[model samples]
Target: MKPSIVLVGRPNVGKSTLFNRLTRTRDALVADIPGLTRDRHYGHGRLGSKPYLVIDTGGFEPLAKDGIMYQMARQAQQAIDEADVVILVVDGRSGVSALDKEIANRLRHANRPVLVAVNKSEGMQHGLVVADFHELGLGEPVAISAAHGEGVRVLIELALEGYPEPGDGEPAEGDSIRVAIVGRPNVGKSTMINALLGEDRVIAFDQPGTTRDAIDVDFERAGRKYTLVDTAGLRRRGKVFETIEKFSVIKTLQAIEEAQVVILVLDARQEIGDQDAHIAAFIRESGRALVVAVNKWDGLDSYVREQIKGALDNQLTFIDFARFHYVSALQGQGLEPLFHSVDAAYKAATINLSTPQLTRTLIDAVARQAPPRNGLFRPKLRYAHQGGRNPPLIVIHGNALDKIPESYRRYLEHLFREVFKLQGTPLRIQFNVSSNPFADKQAPREKRRERKTTDKAKPASGSPARPRSAGKVAAAVKTKRPSGGR
Candidate 1:
C-alpha cells in the first residue's frame, strides 16, 4: 500500500483546489463557495513514479458539538487516523488565524507527521507568510499557491518523507462487484454499509448530507470480494440548498453510473416520494442492476410495511423489475437476502445470450403476441442477436423494424425478461431496419425504354395489316368528285 496523506484545515482554505492539483483530476468538486466539501474525498496522486493516496477532508472544527459541523469534524478525525501523514493547509494571504492555531494544537497531539501548507502564496516572498505559521509549532510552513501550481511538489515530498516503504504485495482484486448505496438524506445508507461491513467504517449520523463524497469500502464476504460505496443523500433539485450539496449530488449520481449494482435504500418510515422514483428512473436509465433496499424495517409494523409496498408500487411502477428487500441496517436484519438479490441482479445484467437462442425467443414472443400491422403491411420480423451487455442489449435486424410499436416493444421486453430471467436488470431491445436492394434498382430511362418496346411490339402471329392501296383509292375518288361537282 502507498502512503496516505490527509488534508485538514478550516473552511475555505483551498484544500479541494490543492487536492485537484495533486490528483491531476477534477474529480473532487471545486468551487469558490466555502464549505463546499463536507466529507472526506479520496483520490490517487503521483509525483513522478511515486504513487500515493490523498484524502481531501471537510473543514476542521474540533469543538463543534451539534449539527453537520460536528459530523464533518468527526469524519476529518477518522481520515487523519488512517493517514500516514497529515498536511494542514492554511490561507497564506489571510495569514495564521485562531482557527489555524486550534487545528495546529489538535495535530500536535495526533502523534503523526504533520506538515503545514500555506496556500495562495504566489506573489509573496518565500519566508514572508511562512513565519506567521511557525507559531502553530507543527513545522516550517511550505508557502505555495494551490491554484497557480507553486510549491505543491515540495509539500507532498515533505509529507511522504518519513513514511515507511511498501512491501512486495499483490495488486488489489479486480473482480469485485462495486455496489453503490444511495438514497435520500438520513435514510441509513451509512448504517447499511456499517452493517454489511460489521464495523463503523463510515461516519453515520442523523443529519442530512452527512456523507458529502462517495466513499468506497472494500471487504470480503462469502469468499467473494465486494466494494461498497457510501454516497451522499440525494435531495430533490429544488430542495438542494448548498453549493457543496449540489457537488455531492453530482458525485452521487456518478457513483450510480460507475457501480455494477445500485442498492437504493429507502426510509421505511417516510412515504414513497417522487424523489425516490426519480432516483429509480435514473438507475434504470443507467442500465445498472438495481436492488431496492427498504431500510429500517425493524420498527415498521405489518400494516405500515404493506402501505410502504403499496406506495412503492404506485410511485415506482416503471421499476417493478427491481427486486425489493426489507432490510434493517441498524439491527443487521435481512442483509443476506439483499446481497443475494444484488448478486443475481449483477449476473442478469451481464449475462450473454446466444444468437440462435435469442432468435428462437424472439420467434416465440412474436407468436405469443402477434406484432401489430403497419398500415397494410405486417412487418416481417427477422433475426435477433445479442448486441451488448450491462442491460443486455438485443438487436433485431429486419425489414421495416422501425415500424415496431412501443406497446409491442414493451411486450417484447417483458417476454425477454421472463424468458431470460432478467428480472432485476433493465433489458434493451434495438431495431435495425434493413432496406431491400432490388426495390428501387430500375432506372427511369430503362423503364421508359421497356414501355416503348412493349407498345411497338410486332402484331401477333397471323394478325392482318392495314391495306395501303385502299387509302390511295379513297384519295383518288375524292379528288375527281371535287373537280367535277364541288
Candidate 2:
C-alpha cells in the first residue's frame, strides 16, 4: 500500500487545488466556493516514481464547540490519525491567523510527521511571503502554488522525506465494480457495511450523522471484487445548516456518479418521505443502476410491508425499473438477495442487444398498438438500436418521430424494458427523425398522381363516369415515398 498523506487546512486555502494538482484529475469539486470540501476525499498521486494516497479534508477549526465546524475538526483528526504524514496548508497571502495557531498546537500534540505548506506563494519573493509563518514553529514552511504547479514537487518530497519506501506488492488492478450505499441519517448504512464485511470497518452509532465522510471499503466476494462506498447519510437541504453535511452530500453525489450501482437504504420503521424519492430520482438522472434496500425489516408485518411496497411504487414511479429488497442490516437478513439483485442490475445496465433483435421488437410492438395518427397522416417508426449503456439507451429512427407523444414514448420504453427484461435500471428511448432530401420532388409526384387519378376517374367522352373510392385515394396519399429515401 502507498503511504497516505492528509491535507489539513482552513476553508479556501487551496487544499483541493493541491489535491487536484497531485492527482492530475479534477475529481475534487473546485470552485471559488468556501467550505466546498467538507469531507475527506481520497486520491492517488505520484511524484515522479513515488506513489502515495492524498486525502483532502474539510477546513479545521480545532476549538469549534458546536455545529459543523466541530464535526469537520473531528473528521480531520480521523484522517490525520490514519495518515503517515500530514501537510498543513496555510494562506501565504493572508498570513497566519489565530485558528492556524490553534491547529498548529493540535498538530504539535499529534506527534505525527508534519509539514507546513504556505499556499498562494506565486510571484512573491521567497522571504517576503514565508517570513510571517515562521512563528507557526512547526518547521520551515514549503512555499508553493498548488494551482500553478509550483514547488509542489519539493513540497511532496519534504513531506515524504524519511517515510519508508512502498513495497513491490501493489493493490490488485482490474475491473472492480463500484457500489455506493446511500440513505438518510441513521439508516444503517455503516452498520450494513460492517455486517457485510463482518467487521467494524466504520463507526456505527445510534446517533445520527456518525459517519461524516464517504469511506470506500474494498473486499472480494465469491471471486468478484467490489468497492463498497459507505457514505454519510443525506438530510434534506432545508434542514441542513451545517457545512459538514453539505460536503457529505456533495461526496455522496460524486460517489453515485462514480459508482456503477447505488444501493439506497431506507428505514422500514419510519415513513417513506420525499427526500428518499428525490435521491432515487437523482440516481436515475445520473444513469446509475439503483437497488432500493429497506433496512430493519426483521419483524415487519405483512400489512406494513405491503404498505411500504405500495408507497415505493407510487413515489418512485420514474425508477420503476429499479429493484427493491427488504433486509435487516443488523441481523444480515435478506442481504444475499439484495446483492444478487445488485449484480443483476449491473448486468442489465450494461447489457448489449443485437440490432436485429431490437428492430424485431420495435416492429412487433408498433404493429400491435400502431403509432398515433396526426390528422390525415399516421407517423411511421422505422427501426431502433442500442445507443449506449449504464442506463441503457435505445435510439429509434423513423418518419415524424419528433411528433411522438410522451405517452407513446413511455409506452415504447415500457415495451423495450419488458422485451429486454430490463429491471433495476432506467431505460431511455430516443427518436431520431430522418429528414428527406426529395421532399419537394415528393409533393410534385403526389400532385401528379392526384391529377392522373382524377383523369382516370373522369368518363371518357360518352362512357359513364366512374366514382373513385376513398381507400384508393388514401393509398395514393400514403404512397408518398417513406420519409428519408430509406
Candidate 3:
C-alpha cells in the first residue's frame, strides 16, 4: 500500500510548490498570494519503485474559529489525521514566524512522524536558514527550494524512510483472486458479497454504516478460487463519526490497495454523488482491476436506468476502462455476468506481453499517428517492454520522450490497450528517454592515447606521409613549389 504524505503549513509557504515537485505534476496550484489553496489536492508519485500518495492541503491557521480559514484549518487537520507522515513547510527566507511556531506546537502531539521543511531556500545558506526553524521543535529543518526542485528528493526519502518497500506487502493466499467490494454507505456492498456467495456471509442491512470492519471470506465458484473482501462503506469525511468509523475507512482504502481486483458498488437509486466518484477515482489511481456494479437495479424504470447510465458517462468518465454491470445484488440477478467480467478483468490485469509484441504495437501506433512535435524536438519512440503487472506497465524506450504530450501518451495507451485487448485495468506507460551517447566529452587520457596512436601509425621523421585519398594526393602533387624550390 502507498503511504500518504500530507503537506501542512501556514499560507503561501510553498506547500503546493513542494507538492508539485514531489509528485512531478502540476495538480497543485502555486502562487505567491496567501491562502491560494482552499481545499485538499491529491496526487500520485513514485520514487524509484516505491509509489506513494501525496496530499496538498490548504494553509493552516490553528486559531481560526469561524470563517473560511476555520474550514480550511479543519480540512488540513483532517488530512494530518489521515496522513502516515506529515511535512510542515515553512518559509525560510521569511524566517520562522509566530504562526509557524503555533502550527509546530499543534503537530508536536500528532503522534506521527513529522518533518520540517524550509522552503524557498534555494541559494541561501542551508545551515543558517534551517537554524531558525529548529526552535519550532518539530525536528531538524531541511532546506529546500520547491520551485527549483532542490532537496525535495531527500525530504521525501526521509519522510518515507521506515515504510516497507513496494511489492513487500503480504502475498495473496494460493491462487485466489483477491477482490474487494467498496463504495459509499448503503450501496449494497454486503448484499453483493452475500449474493455472490449464495450465503449470508456478511450482515447486509438497509441502514447506512452497518459494516464497521473489513471482512475477508474465502470461497470457490465454478472451480475457481476467490477471496472476497467486504469493506465498510465510505462516507464523506464531514459525516464520518466516531474513531472506529475513521479507522474503518482507512481499512477500506487499504483493502482496495491490497486486492487484485475491486468491485465498486454504486447505489442505483441515489444520484451519483461526489463520494462515489471519489471512491472510483481512488480505485483507478490504485491501478486495481475494476468492475463497477450498480446495485439495487431491480426496480428502476427504463427511463431512470437510462438517466443513471448517462450520469455515469458524464461524471465517472475517468473510469471508462472498467466494465459496469447494472445488477440487483439482493436478488442475485446479474451475478453470472458480473463474475465473468471480474474474471476477465483479473486476467487482463495480470496478463504478460512479449517484448516483440509490445514493440510491434508501439511501432504500429506511431506509424499510424506520430506524436506531435514539441518545438524543435520531435519525440522518437523506439521500443517497448513490460515493466510490471497487476497494473500493466509498458516501459517505452525512446529519444526526446520527455517532450511527449499527455494527449499523445493517452493515444499510445489507447492503442496499446486495443492491441492487447486489455480491458478493465488501468495501463501505465513509463517513458525512458535514452541518453545521447555522443553527448559526453572524451577523457583527457583517452584523447592523448588516440593522438599518440595516430602519430605511431604515421610515416617516420624523414619520410613524407602518403595521402590516402587519390584526390587529396593529386591536389598535393599539383601544388606549385614555393619560391622556385621543391
Candidate 4:
C-alpha cells in the first residue's frame, strides 16, 4: 500500500490550491473566499514511481482554539498520527502568524517527518518574505506558487522521499481485489470484518471509536484473492470534539483513497445523510468501484427495500455507475447479490470494448444528447481508450476538457453501462480536449455553406428571398426531396 500525507495550514493559506495542483484536479473547491473548504478532501499523489495519498484539511485559528475552527485544527493534528509524512503550508505574503507557529509546535511534538511549504512566492521580491519562514526551525522551506504551479515537482519529490513502495523483485503484485467496508460509526464495520475473517480481527463494540486504525486483512475467498479493510467509523464534528480522535478522521479519509472497491454499507433503518454522501463523494472523486450495500437488511419488506433504494437513488445522484444491494452481514441474506455487484463494479473498472464499438456508441450517445457546453465550446469527448485496471481508467481526448461537468460525465457513464453492459465495477472517465469544440463542428458549417451557395445560385432577379418558417421548411423538404433533405 502507498503511504499517506496530509497538508495542514490556517485559512486562506493556499492549502486547497496546493491540493488541486498536486492532485492535477480541482477536487477541492477553490475560491477567493476563505473557509470554502468545510471538510477534509484527500487526493491521489505521486512523484517518480512513488504514490501516496494527500489530504486537504479545514483551516485553523488561534482565538477559536477550543471552538469549531479549533476542531478543524485538531483534525489537522490528527493528520500527523496517520501520515508517514506531513506538509505544513503557510502563506508567504502574510509572513508567519502565531497559528502557523502553533501547528509547527504540534507537529514537532508528534515527531513525524514534516515538510514546510511557503506558498505564493512567484516573484523575486517575495523570496525575502518567504525566507523568514525558515525561522520555524524546520529546515529550509520550499517556496511555491500553487495557482501558477511553480516548484510543485520539487515539493512532491521532497514529500515522497520517505515513502517508497516495497518491491518484491517479481512482476508487480497480482491485482488483489480491495474491498473497503465503509459506513457511519457503530454500523457493523468491525462486525462484518470479524465475520469475514471468522476471528476477532477488529474490536466489535456498540460504542464508536472501537477501531481507529484502518486495518487491512488479506485473505482468499474460495480461490479469489481479496483484501478487506475495516476503516474507522466516521463521526460528525459535533460528536467528537476532542483533539485525539483526529487521527481516526485522517485514517478514514486515507482508507477511502486506498481502496479499489468501496462497500458503502448503510444502516438498514437509518436514512442516508450528509456523512454518507460525503464518503460517497470520496469514492466518486477517486474514480473507484462502488457497491452500495444496505447492511442489516434482513427482516425487511419490499416497501422498505424500495424506500431504501429510492432514498439512495435520490441521494446518490452523482454515482450513476454504482450498483446497490441490501445485505445482512449477520445472516448473509443478500451477500451473493452484493458480491455480484462488487464483481460487476470490478469489471466496470476494467471493462474494455473494441474501439470501433466505443466510437459507435459515442456517436449514438452524442446524437441522442448533445455534448454539455462550457461557454462557446461544447466539451466534446471525441474518443476514449481503456488504460488501467483495479479501477478502470478510460482516457477521453476532447475539447474544453475542464468544462465537462460531473453530470454530463455521468450521463455518458450511464449510457456506456446501459449499452455495453458494464456491471458492478466503478470506472474513471478522464477528459482531454485538444481543439475547440466550436471550431471543429461540421454539420452546422456544412448547412451554412450550403445555404450560402443556394442563395448565390438562386435566379438572383425578383425571386424574393421569402424566409421559410418551420412548417414551410418541412413542406419544402418533403416536396423537393422525398427522403427529407434541405
Candidate 5:
C-alpha cells in the first residue's frame, strides 16, 4: 500500500547498498560483488517528511540470460513492474552503457513514474563523466555518491513526489500527508517528529510537558508536501483529569482525530508502559492507522532487546496488524524504514481491490495450494468474495469449515501476498461451509432414518400395517357401535 519505490539499473550500481542505507538497517544482502541481490528484498523506508516502501531489486542486464544473473534480471524487471515509482540508478563512475539504454527502454514501456539516479558522483572530476548519462532520455539524473550519503536526500525528495495525492476530496489533497505526532509526556514524541522533519517546526525542550497545544507546520521534501502536527504530550491516568489539563486533553484528542495517521513514540531507554499501550488503544479506538515508533533505539543492547520488543508487541496482539519501528530520534537513525512502513500501512488501508482481479488472484492462489482438509471430508472451498475493506476481509465458503488449519490459512495468506501484492496490509479470512452441492440434502442416513420411523410407528408387531380399505371398515364399525352404546 505504501507507494513502492524500486531501484533499477545495471548491476553494481549500489542499489542494495542504498537500500541498506535508506532503511537504516541491513535488510538486503550487500556485497561488493555484482548481482549479489537476486530476489527482491524490500524494507520500509522514508525521506524528508514522507514514508514509502523501498524495494531493492537485482541489477538489470541486457544481452545476457545465460545464468543466475538472467534470473536476477527477471526478478528486477518484476519489481519494476510492481513499483509505483522506479529509480534507474546508473553508476556515475562507469557512465552509461548499452544495458542502461536497454533498461531505460524497458522502463519507458513500464509507464510507471520513474527517476534517473546517477550514483558515485563524487568530486568535480567525475561530474563531466556523469553528465553524458543524460542521453538515456528518462530525464535529468540525480547525481550523487550513495556510499558517501551525498545527493541521496535530493533524489529521495524527487522520488517522494511520485506519491499521488489522496483520493479527490480528501482535505490536504494538494498538501502533505498530515501526520499527528503523539505520545505520553516526556516520551520525546515532539523531539522525534522534529528530528525526522529536520527543522524546528515545533519547539523542543527537556521539559516533560512543554508542548501543551497542537501546532501544525507545512513541511516539504523534494516538492512533496507533508503536514506535521505536534501536540501536547499525554500524561498518566490517575493524574489525567486535572482542571488545568482539560484543554490539553481535548486538544490532544482533536489532534489525533484530525490526523490521517498517528505516530505513537515510545522511549526505548525505558520499558514500555501502560501509558504507551493506552495511547495505541486510543488511536485504534479512534479508527486511525497507528504506527508504534520506539524512539532512542540506539541505546538498546544486544541482550534483552528482543525481550523488550516482544513486550511492546504483546500489547498489539489483538491487532495482528499494526506497524512498529525502532528509531533513534536524537541520532536520526532507523527513520527511513519506519516512515516507509507508515506510508505503506496507510496506503494499504485505503486501497480497494477490483473484484475481477481479486477473483482471478484468489483462484490462482487456490490452484497453487489447496484449502485445508478437515478429514476425508475436505472443506470444499467454493469461491471467495471480498466481504469488506479498510483492512480488507475475504470470506471463503466451503463445507466442514471448522477444521481448516492455521497452516493452510497461512499458505493462502502467502499466495494472496504474491498474487494481489497486499504488502503491509492486514488480511482477514472467514471460512464458510455449506451442504454438499450434488445432494438434495446430506448423505442418505437421515432420510433412511425418517422412513424407518414412519414404518415403525404404523406396525404394532411382526405383521404389516392395515390397508386403506381395512381402515375404512374399522372406522365405519367403530362409529355404528359407539352410537348404539350411547
Candidate 6:
C-alpha cells in the first residue's frame, strides 16, 4: 500500500495548490477564498520512483461546533488520523495566527509525523519565514512556494524520507478491467457496487454525497478480475455551493479518465434531466466503454418504465452504442446480464483489428456508399489499421480525406462498428491524408534526373560539344606534351 501524506491548515494556505503540484494535476480547486476545500481530496504522487498518496482537506476550524466549519474539521481530522505524514501548510506572508496555533495543537496529538510548510515564501528570506513557524513545536519548517513550484520537491522528499522504495507488486497490465460508476447525486452507485460485490465493501447510504472520494474495490466474477471504482456523484456546478462538492466532481472525472469502462447509474423514479444528458455526453466524449444502469427499477410500472426508456432515447441518442439495463440494485434483479454486457464491452473496446481486415471493411463500405464529394475533391479512403485500443481507434490512410464531411465519417463509424461487432465501446476514426508526391514539386531523385537530362539536351554557351569534352581534350594535350619531354 502507498503511504498517505495529508495536508492540513487554515483556509487559503495554498494546500490545494500544493496538492496540484505534488500530483502534477490540477485536480484540486484553488482560490483566495477561505474554506474552499471541505472534503478530503486524494491524489497520487511520486518522488523519483517512490509512489505515495496525497490528501488535501479543508481548513481546520477545531473550535467550530456545529456548522459547515465543524464538518470540515471532522473531515480534516479523519485525514490526519489516516495519514502516515502530515504537512501543516501555513501562510508565510501573514505570520503565525491563532488558528494556525490551534491547528498545530490539534496535530500535536495526531500521533503522526508532522511537518510545517511555510507557503508563499518566494521572495522573502526562507530562514525568516520558517523561524516564525518553528514556534508551532513541529520540527524544522520547510519554506515552499506551492504556486511557483519552489522547494516542493524538497518538501515531498522530506515527507517521504523514511519510507522504503516501493516494490514491483503492482498488478500487471491487463490484469483487470477498471470500471468507474458515475452519475448525479444519490444515484445508487455505491449500492450497486455493494450488490455486485455481495458484501458491504463501501458505505451505501440513502443520502447524497455519502461517497466523497473515489473508492476502488477489487473483486473477481466468473474468474475474471475487475477493479470497481466507486466515484462521487456529480451535481450541477450552479448548485454546487460547498467547495468540497466542486472537487468531488473533479475526482469523478479523474476516475472516469483512469477507468477502462464506466457504469453510469441513473434513477428510474426521476425524469432524465440535463445533468444526466451532460454526464452521458461526457462519457461518450471520453471514449470509454459504457453500460447504463437504471437503478430502483424493481417497483416502477410498465408505463413509467416505457416513459423512462423513451426519455433516455430522446435525451441520450448520442450514446446509442452503449447497452442499457434496468437494474434493481437492492434486489440484484438485472445485475448478471449487466456483467455480461460489461465483459462484452470490454472485449470490444480492446479487440484487435488487423490492417488487411480493416482495409477490406473500408473498401466494402465505400463500395456500398462512396463518400460525398466536396466540390472538386473526392475523398478516397485507401486502407486502415488499428491505431489504439480500449476505445479502439482506426487510422485510415487516404487522399482528400480532409474533405470528408461529418455525415460520411458517421457512416464509416457505423459500418465499422457493425462489421467489428463493437457494441458497447465508442469507435474513433482518424484520417491520415496521404500527400501527393508531385503536388508541390518533384522528388529529390526525380529533380536530380531532370537536371541531368536538361544538361544533356542543352549545349554549352560557346561550344556545341558535350560539357565533359573540354576536360577530355585538356587531358589528351597534357599527355602528349609530357611524352615529348620524356
TM-score winner: 3
TM-score for all predictions?
A: 0.59, 0.58, 0.75, 0.72, 0.47, 0.60
Residue-level lDDT of model 3, residues 1-486, one tens digit each, is: 679899999999999998998889888877789999987777778888788878888999999999999988987887888889999999998998999999999998888799999999988889999998989988788999999988989999998897877762224556788899999988899988888888898998989888988899999998889989999988887787555665577668878988989999999999999999899988988889999999899988999999999999999988989999999988899889999999999989988899999999999999999989889878999999999898999999999999899999999988988989999999999999999776555577688999999988887877787658988888988884678674
Ranking by lDDT: 3, 6, 2, 1, 4, 5
Question: Could you tell me the TM-score of candidate 6?
Answer: 0.60
Residues 2-55 of candidate 6: C-alpha lDDT, one tens digit per residue: 577899999999999999999999999998899888877877788997877788
**Which runs in model 5 stand beyond 4 Å of their true positions?**
1-175, 239-241, 246-258, 281-287, 299-301, 304-307, 313-323, 360-378, 385-389, 395-423, 430-486
**What local lDDT score does residue 21 receive in model 2, on the 0 to 100 scale?**
95
Using lDDT as the measure, the top candidate is 3
Every candidate's lDDT: 0.85, 0.85, 0.88, 0.76, 0.72, 0.88
- Tens digit per residue, CA lDDT, model 5, 1-486: 346688887888899878887888877887789878876665666665355668888878855767977767766766676677899988887777889999999889998888988887778464585679778888877787777888888888887775654332134458567678898777787777778788766778886778877888776765667677888878663555334443365466656755666788888777777777777766765546667787877866877678877886676664445677888887888888877776776676556667667667667776877666655766556667776554566777666767888888877766765676555455667787776676866558788999999987886778786677988988988777544553
lDDT of model 2 at residue 78? 73
Cα distance off (Å), candidate 6, residue 388: 0.4
Model 5: weakest 10-residue lDDT segment is 164-173
Q: How much does candidate 5 score in TM-score? A: 0.47
* Candidates, ranked, TM-score: 3, 4, 6, 1, 2, 5
Model 4, 397-470: lDDT tens per residue? 76677877788888887887787777655556777668645766888899999999998888777866777699
In candidate 1, what are the lDDT values of residues 216-271, reduced to their tens digit? 99998888888899999987756876656655755676678678889999999887
Going through the candidates in order, what is the number of backbone clashes in each?
0, 1, 0, 11, 9, 0
Candidate 3's C-alpha runs over 4 A off are 168-176, 197-203, 207-227, 231-255, 273-278, 302-318, 359-383, 396-419, 429-486
